[model samples]
Target: MIAIPVETDNGTPMSTKLFGNAKFFALVEPKSKDYTIIPNEGCGNGIQTANYLLEQGASSALYGFLGDGPFHVMVRGGMNVYWLGKETMPLDQAIDTALSETLVHVTTENASLYLDPGTAAGACECGCSHD
Candidate 1:
């Protein structure tokens, strides 16, 4: 299963909203996992978030427009990226579209982290840092 590290206004996962302006850094296979959210930093930029995921054993990411810096780091780290969805769709449907291949032009950008048997630094330093 895909582990999505979403940015939330509330302290709830189902209630949480994926930070629209936030940069998604990693798409992790839930099986190999450990993570931390860096707190009080606005939503994480694509690069920092991505790096955090890399530190946490992520091999891929599913998100939208990424700036050059974060885009580059993801490539260097070996993460597979597929850009999809508009702000209109809810997160679950968006993810579903991606899986079903019904989504088009969703992946405006693409990159990879290139690491094998990825490693995670635990959420303490990354995702959990946000709390």
Candidate 2:
């Protein structure tokens, strides 16, 4: 399952920022196209959110932005993170895009805490160099 942070529970567009503060997350089963919205019980707590996702069987996550701590925790916990940029599209569309592999796959080798497209131009803090 993949989790996409959303601003509302009724299939509204996903939030463009503040993954830790999102009100809801749409859990999607890619193969079956089944989805459900769950309250973000870990709101404001990145680690808690990561753990919650893992507990709920999420193997990956799609978000517009994520903090350094939570990103690291999620990656370490075996969840792949995909960046959806700043676009605010419906959760279902996001899911479809992810399934199609159109999102930027955030990895420790290339991830930056900041989302500025022109600013991610150096060795990642996780110690991987792009050179």
Candidate 3:
């Protein structure tokens, strides 16, 4: 199942931001084109949110943006992260894009939100600046 953060339970459209502080999550099954909207009881805690998604049988998450800590937690839990870009479209369209293999796969290296300042500056492996 793929989890998509949405503003409402009706699933008309996806949230503009990531799952952070979201009130609901739409757990979608691509094959059947069915989905369940669930409340996010984790509050704003990233780790807790990740655990919640796992408990709901989510194999992947589609979002507009995600922070570093949450991204790592989701990745460690064996969940694929996909970026929906800057467009805010209907939930069904997003699912279609994902199923058609046109969404951008998010990874540590390419996820600019998670990049450390030292790492981006070509600092040592220890993440310490020599300057």
Error of 1 at 79 (Å): 0.8
For model 3, the superposed segments whose C-alpha errors exceed 4 Å read: 11-13, 113-131
Report the Cα lDDT for candidate 3: 0.71
Candidates' C-alpha lDDT: 0.41, 0.74, 0.71
Tell me the number of clashing residue pairs for each predicted model.
30, 0, 0
Q: Least lDDT summed over 10 consecutive residues: which range in candidate 2?
A: 122-131
When sorted by TM-score, best at the front, the candidate numbers are 2, 3, 1
Q: What is the TM-score of each candidate against the true structure?
A: 0.49, 0.81, 0.78
lDDT of 3 by residue, 1-131 (tens): 99887777763756546465667888899899788888888746555776789888899987775556666767878999888775567778877887988887888778775323122343223212222
Clash pairs, candidate 3, are none
Give the range where candidate 3 is weakest over 10 consecutive residues by summed lDDT.
122-131
Cα error of candidate 3 at position 73, Å:
0.7
Count steric clashes of candidate 1.
30
Best by TM-score: 2
Query: On residues 5-78, what C-alpha lDDT tens digit does candidate 2 reach at each position?
Result: 88888635555455766778888989997888999899876667777888898999987756566777788889
Error at 21, model 2, angstroms:
0.6
Candidate 2 colliding pairs = none
